[model samples]
Target chain A: MLMRCIRAEMRKLRGAGIWWVFALLPVISAAYGTFNFMQNREILTNGWYSLFTQHTLFYALFFFSPMVGVYAAYLWRMEHMGGGMNMLMTMPVYPFCFFAAKGAAVLAVTLLTQGWVFALYMLCGRTLCGLTGWPPLQIALYMLRGLLGALPVVALQLLLSMVIRSFAVPVLIALVGGVVGMALVAQDAGIWWPYALVLLGMNANRAQDQLSGGLGVYVLVCLGFTALLCLLAQALLTRRDVRA
Target chain B: MRAAMLAERIKAARRHDLLLAALTGLLTALCAAVRPEEDWQRAVGYSALTVNLSLMNAVVMPLAMAALASRLWDMETRGSGCRLLFTLQSWESLFGAKALRGLVQNVVICLAEGAVFLLAGRMWGYTQALEIPRVLWLMLCTFVVNAMRFFALLALSVRSGTQVLPLAVGLACSLLSVFTAFMPERLTLLTPWAYDVPLSAMRMHYDRETRITAYEPLAFPAGLLAAAVVCGVLGYVLARRAVRDQEV
Candidate 1:
């Protein structure tokens, strides 16, 4: 059922509105990189990496994370919009299964979107800087660190989308939360700062020295918080929003 | 005219006050007061004030524009213009009225807060580049930027029934940052305000030789004004469609 729901979501995105967002992504990415290319053409490769490194969290905080959440919330909303919620609620499927399916669908879309971003970066690198080579091993490590960092953001967004009724509320909250997170990040006592989780996924290549010295408890702390957030999300869903 | 009806439609859709009040209160009370001083002796009283201003402007309120946008029409009663508003016509007029209303409301609240901060600073005998008026200027700058922002967003909501949360914010911050980043030496000779005041007065520059870049009011206001025009046009188009689109 979850897989089925994921397929449906893919099909639904085939609509004009959702595809416009997808189309807008590459254009925006290219535009932003072009802006960078114009300013610091010499550091194009490192610049792209740094741009992704710093901006990924910014994206998660303000845009992508909340987008995924809103996308999920709207899955429920689509039903309501179509006057199908009553039928869905009375269907043979468990209520939890319905949300679970939406969760899977959102995750699939997130990874697909991220994959597009990765491709966009590669393509932009080749076109803007006229380079045809892959970045160093540290680049992958940096991306991994970023993904790890974004884990909690993903979880929190999921929670917001799951419970919030208004289609716009969760994303709004996430945007507000993102700002608050960035301000308090430097003062963070530890990596448990969920907003700072995106920092966990940061490419430590710039500070290669830090990675070799050991992730210095930050990595574990991020993972710990990610786990904590996931548990909280699961519990929250079961209790109110996503029932079995 | 029918334009008044459409404006009322949009007005009913959104809830601007929630965003305004939350941002004002949050920035004043929570955002501005974070970890005030690393060490009191090292901290200039005004420097603390700058941190307060920076948080208040950049982090707290600017990003809420989308939420304000989302609410703009969501709060509308049946998504129609106020039957009573006699002054509106065309989608642009409706958008203008809403945008102007939002700007005035934000500015008024901000000014009221400025008075309190001004009195406090005078009591502390704090007189420097970071003055109450400068802070007020930053707030106004934020207000102008946000007015354009909220306007564009509400306009988008009118067109599409929903606004892209992240996209709206990225654009707003990048727009806002242009003003906040450089100060002192360079001429952002971009606007009257940037020219009238010290561009870097409210800015914090950590890594440059001059430390802060001078403000460029011209470029920012131009960008913001252009955004206002484009968004206003698009929002009006959306509202027109929404009015015509059969309810689902």
Candidate 2:
């Protein structure tokens, strides 16, 4: 049933033309990142590491989470409109399956975007930066870790989009969350904040692995937040009256 | 028109549009409060604060305007309220009411931000005298930029019948605005979203070795400001037409 729900969600998204959002934002970020890196070449001499930070700085800090918000909002948009919520509640599928399906769909898109961002990073590092030996193994690890870190954000945004009928409000919240997360990370409190996790995981604007000493805590926090959001969503789905 | 505007206000009140204003104020305060104390002691501290505040505005305003403009129209789009509402009122009156309400909200938000900047400066115990005129200038520039964005997004929402496009474009514009700070000045002027920083009354320079940051006053960019006004008027005209010609 959950598989069926996931497929339904994917089907709804087919030919929605949202892929351009996931594609265009990173290209813009990469363009800016590479330009900034080149302009400050003398100071940013860490080669691929410096280049990686440049690429992910704004992408992680500003663009990525909001893109996730857009996807989550789009997924729930149809459901929130004109008798759709009532129809959804009447369906035999468990609310958990309904919510999980949306999360999974958003997760799949996020995973693809993360890989694309990394691909752009590597391409820029090699062709633009011009000195790359297979790109460091740690960079791939950072990309993977960034993907892992995005789970809680995806969950939280999914939950928000579910509750907020306004397509833009949830996305605005994500942007503000990203800004607040940047502040929290600056105060060395990234692991505790779900929005900060992705920034920490990406090691944005820094050459060193930000979560090196606290990787376990980071992973645990991500899982904890995701689980909490899931429970909240389920309770809201099963207990609350449909707004429609 | 007055009746229509009053009705728009009542609708906005019920919709809790003021919350977005509060959010904007709170964000400005947060941005102000987060600066380190040491930075406030420098000779150019107040000017530096102004520059930073402009950058923060650049980041925050696009999304806020997008959300506000989208929300104002989304209610009508949902359940085909636009058709029902059009039956009762002229499209020009309806469009004017929304635009006027949005303009008023934008003013309130800018005033709140300027107030917060003043309050934060006082709390931080800065000795530099607060320049009321300069702050007002910054606020006015911010209002212009936000009005432009709000109208653009409002037009898009009305035409597209979907809030997603305006919001997505808003997110993209926010990202580009931040990056615009890094681009050449001539190029930055071309992107309306990037106007907050360029229109700022002060600019900051940091000396890497000495680690001293200085702020210099800049003549207000009248040409860009005029361009923004032109774009905003164009957006208003387009949005009005969209409402007038809307099939229902």
Candidate 3:
């Protein structure tokens, strides 16, 4: 039943304008990446890795975090409309199931964005920068790690979106969170800083130097944080009276 | 007119935009404070303040404007308020009131920011004294720039009936504006978001022979004024049309 609910939620998004965000975000990030890459070409001697690092930083800090926040807010928008929440509660489905399905859809979108971002990163490395040596293993690993890292952000956004009826508040917090995360990333507190996880995961400059234990710690932190957020969200959803 | 403005103030108070505006100001101040001392602790205090403030304005104000505009519009459109507002006053009057609210919010934010910048400068031990003319010039420029964005975004918000899109566009612009520091002044003038880029160039430059860091206001470019005027006119026209076309 839960699977059916999740699939239905995903199916409902077909032909919706929500997909434009996913399509446009990568292109926008790529354009910025290419711009920065070309601008720094004279100074950047580390080749593909340096360019990729800058690209991933821009993607993680600005584009990806806000996208998660907006995606979560968009998921709840339908229900938050006047009398919509009450109408939804009248349905036979449990609130937990409804929220779980929505959360799953958001996660799917996050992974989709991560996959496209990874593809664009590699493409930029190959064609634009003319780095022929394919770092396939590292690229795949970073992609998976980035996706895992983003899970906590996705869950937190979902939790916020579900709790706060105001659409902008969740997004505002997320944007502020992302901006703050950039500052936090330098401090090397990735275990506690979910916002910095995406940057830490896909950062070629830092990751290339310390890939083994560093990444494992990030993955563990991200997973633990994601689990805590998901559980908290579930508890909150179940306890909430449908008054929206 | 007084009644309309008063009512708008009450509505704005309820919406908590003033709080958001102040919060944004404090956040911008905090973000500016996070900068390494060397960046802002230049030989000439005026240059340092201008540079630091310009960077903060570029990064923070655009998003704040979008969010505040969207939130105000959303509050009006949430339920029957959208339909009811038109009945309470003429579309022009309603538009005026809302525009006034935005202006009030902007003024509050601007004042808060100015206070913080002064406090930050003093605390950071800026070597040069506080230069009023340059400080006032940047403040006025930022005010106009923010007002222009508010008008444009309010129009977009009213027409679209959603805050997220306009906010997203603003966020994207804010991201792009970070690179405006690198672009030529002429190109920066093309985008309203980079109104500060020219001023940001007025940093304490090192002289080769004298071995001194000279502090000066980069000549106020005529092109930025033109850009501000263009944005103002465009925003007004769009806003007029939006308010006129608003059904609910």
Candidate 4:
């Protein structure tokens, strides 16, 4: 039943004009990073992982999380409009199931977008910088880890969109999270901050830097925080009376 | 028209829009203050502080203008307000009032930023005395640049209907503005987003090898003012057309 609901939610998003919000950030990030890489070609070494890492640091630091917020907000936009929430609540389905299906669909889109960005980064690096080594396994590992680290951002943004009703607030929160995350990346405690997790995870995979001992703890924190937020959202949705 | 302008003023004040702008100015000031105490005495000079603030402003102020414009415009378009707003007043008057309010708010915020620079300079042991004319000129340039951006956003808001599109575009431009400092001079003149680049009150001459630095006034206030007038008229025309289409 939940699978059907999720499929139905996905169908609603077809031709919905929200895809650009998902695609723009990654494309811009990769293009800008590629431009910078080429401009500094003399200074930068042409290794595959090295080139890929330089481009993606800005992505992980700034674009990835906020783009997730945009996706979540786009998904919730319809339900927030024109008595739609009240109408949905009047139906016989469980509120948790209804929200879970939407959440599932958004999560899928988020992961797909991340994968596309990863592939695009590799393609750009190979073409522009004469990257040679396949490094397929390393690339996959970084994508998987960064996607894992982004789970909490997805949950937090979903919950914020679910509750806030205002379109810009959730997105601004996510953008501010990226700014705060960037600031925290300079301090020792950045590894513990949930907003900074994806950044730290990406940094751990860089070819130049030795993987810090705290990478394991960072992964655990991301998973734990995701679980907590998901549970909190579920509890809140079950209790609230839906109103226009 | 007077009633419409008054209504717009009340709505703006009620929404705490000015407060948000003031807070942004303060935040920009705080960002400028991130220097060591030793640098604070010597290196944290007027032109240097202005350059730092201008760089931060390039990243932030465009989006802030977009947000403010969208909030003002979107409030009238969300749900029942859309239908009611059109019926109550001519769209021209409404648009005019809102645009005026936005322009006034931006000018005030620009001045507030200038005031912040003066305070930051004096408080941080800036060696030079307050150079009010140069600081005011920078403020004027910022105001003109933001006016152009605000007008562009107003046009976008009228056409897009939804709040997200204008915002997303504005933010993308804001992100691009971060790199404008490094852009070549000819490119800077062509890219509307790079207007802030020319407004950098600090003229930096860095010796790539020797690494010596010097500061002078770097501003093209007249050029920015001319651009503002042109973009402002274009925005007005576009918004007027959008309203006409809505009426049809």
Can you tell me which runs of candidate 2 are displaced by over 4 Å? A242-244, B9-14, B32-34, B39-43
Candidate ranking under DockQ, highest first, comes to 2, 3, 4, 1
Q: Which pairs of residues have clashing backbones in candidate 4?
A: none
DockQ each candidate and list the results: 0.19, 0.63, 0.36, 0.31
Cα lDDT, model 2, residue B33: 53
lDDT of each: 0.50, 0.84, 0.73, 0.72
By DockQ, is 1 or 3 better?
3
Give the number of the best model, judged by lDDT. 2
Candidate 1, position A135, lDDT: 54
Residue-wise C-alpha lDDT for candidate 3, range A1-244, written one tens digit per residue: 6898799778867775567667776776776777778877776667766666766766776557777888888888778878777876777877778778987999888888877877887788888878778765766777777788888988888888887777776777776676667666656665477777877777643636444667667777888998898889778867767663
How many Å off is the CA of B66 in candidate 1? 2.5
**Winning model by TM-score:** 2
* Tens-digit per-residue lDDT, A1-244, candidate 2: 9999999999988888578788888988998889999999999998888988988998888778889999999999998888788889888889789899999999999999998998898888889878668778888888888998999999999999999877888888888788788778888876788888888988886777778788898888889999999999999998966553
DockQ of 4: 0.31
What order do candidates take by TM-score, descending?
A: 2, 3, 4, 1
Residue A152 lDDT in candidate 4 = 85
Could you tell me the lDDT of residue B33 within candidate 4? 48
lDDT of model 4, residue A7: 88
Best by DockQ: 2
RMSD per candidate (Å) reads: 7.0, 1.8, 3.6, 3.5
Candidate 3: misplaced stretches above 4 Å?
A: A204-212, B2-14, B34-49, B79-81, B122-128, B204-217
Comparison by DockQ, 3 against 4, better one: 3
